[model samples]
Target: MKKHNFSAGPSILPQEVFEKSAQAILDFNGSGLSILEISHRSKDFVAVMDEARALVLELMGLTGKGYHAIFLGGGASLEFARVPYNLLKEGGKAAYLDTGTWAAAAIKEAKFFGQTEVIASSKADNYSYIPKGYTIPADADYFHYTSNNTIFGTQMQQFPDTDVPLVCDMSSDIFSRQLDFSKFGIIYAGAQKNMGPAGATLLVIKEELLGKTGRAIPSMLDYKQHIDKESMYNTPPVFAVYTSYLTLQWLKNNGGIAAAEAKNNAKAELLYNEIDRNPLFVGTAKTEDRSKMNVCFLLKDEAHTEQFDKLWKAAGISGLPGHRSVGGYRASIYNAMPIESVQVLVDAMQELEKSIQ
Candidate 1:
């Protein structure tokens, strides 16, 4: 049975990407050296890094717009601190929207760097809905938010437009949709989710936004240093960056972000429609805020949980379990997940409902 992958992070990637990466591991570009053993300073690997950075800018519509893309060794969690370290100035206040777990974590890290204020939050409701109608402080040095909440299954439908510099951690939803990249001063994402395997983080920073923080940033955490060195200031994550490059190539071949969003919406709809229709199931997030990438749901009747679990398992499903903190089910329908796999999941849900009825 072919397994349907729905893992949250280090998730599914295009089959073609996997095949190409495997071949490159053995002998990269006919150079007779494994991608693993290849030198980071090599001309061949430099080409890969350059292409990956260029592709990220192109896909986000930031090409030649004073935006520099860099891949780093740390994940998005590290970026939570790095963002404030490089942007939140001393004695200046930073505003954040607390939509879910990651957003809360970002707020926690920002406090260490400066005066951090949570302008809005939906944690009171277990983060089922995205907060709205809250005022962002005009005097804030910058505003930070997570574009998608993987654990809570909520995504901000639209970004807040504020004079304060906008920074985002798009770890779970980057490249999953089309966006006006010009609106954000900075955007960072972990490559594991929609981009590629774990190990590298993608950062798209506006050139003019650096040096305003007035703090002595560590070498690795400084965006200007990474940009000046062309993402080669230190030994980069070679394997992860290469895989991400392949994935970006795949996205470009598949018609870029717009095409991915169409498929992602379709897959989310297929499963969410079932969750709403089936009397045995119900979605976790509010209808309007439901995440297209991570769809969290639960069985309506707790007694039937085991039956539903076995139903999906028997149908070759994997990673349907929710985060441990939230005991439910989360179906992560990323860019690489096909609509057919979603239909299979929907069919399994329908079959289980029928059996119970």
Candidate 2:
């Protein structure tokens, strides 16, 4: 059976990316060596790295705007520490907006470096909504927030207007929609979502933001060092970076972020509309703060759980179960998820209602 994948991370990618990556694994760039065996220092791989970094900036409309894009080895979790290490000066404060598990994790990391202030949070409400009307400390080194919450099903529809260097962890929603990319001092995301497989994280930093932390940073965690070396600081994640390059090429060919946003919005609408209209279901997140990338909802009656689960599974829907923290179902409609797949989930929901009635 053809499966409609909805796993949150290391998730679905464009079909062409899979095909091309597989071919490269067998014979990379027409060379006898697989992409896996090829040296990261090779001319071919260097070109791949160069183009991937450039494409990140180009696709986000940040090219030549004093922004540098680098693909790093650790997941965004590593960045939770590196971000404050490089940006937060000793005894200086950093501001954060807590909306989900990952955001809280970042705050935890930031606290180690200096004073970390949570300007706003929705944790008291089980993180079902985005907090607003919070004040960012102007004296803080930077302001950080997660753009989308994959586990909780909430996304920031609008960003806060702040002069404090804006830092964002966009792991779940990067490249899914359009935004003013220039406003952010830093933006980072794990490659598993819209980019590629796991093993790589993309970080786009404004050049001027680096080298100001009065404390000495280990070379591995220094953004300036990586940028100076042109993202070839270490061996790098060869396969992950190349596959991410292929995905970005795919995005550029398909009319870039604007086009992807259109598809993403359509997919979310299809699923959320069914969740709202169907008497058998109820959405978990606040109506106004619902994520376009991850739509979470629950059956109205727990008695129908077994039936609903079977219906979606029978319809070839995989990864339909929500995170353990938020039980029920979560349909992650990322940039690459087709509207047709979302319809399958909606149909399953409708089927459950009819059968139960």
How many residue pairs collide in each prediction? 0, 0
lDDT of 2: 0.94
Give the range where candidate 1 is weakest over 10 consecutive residues by summed lDDT: 324-333
Assess candidate 1 and give its TM-score to the true structure.
0.99
Prediction 2 TM-score vs. true:
0.99
Residues 1-357, model 2: lDDT tens digits: 999999887799999999999999999999899999999999999999999999999999999899999999899999999999999987899999999999999999999999999989999999999998899998999999999999999999999888999999999999999999999999999999989999999999999998888999999999999999998889899999999999999999999999999999888888888988999999999999999999999888899999888888999988988999999888888888989999988898899889978
Runs in model 1 deviating more than 4 A are none
- Model 1, 236-280: lDDT tens digits are 999999999999999999999999999998898788888999988
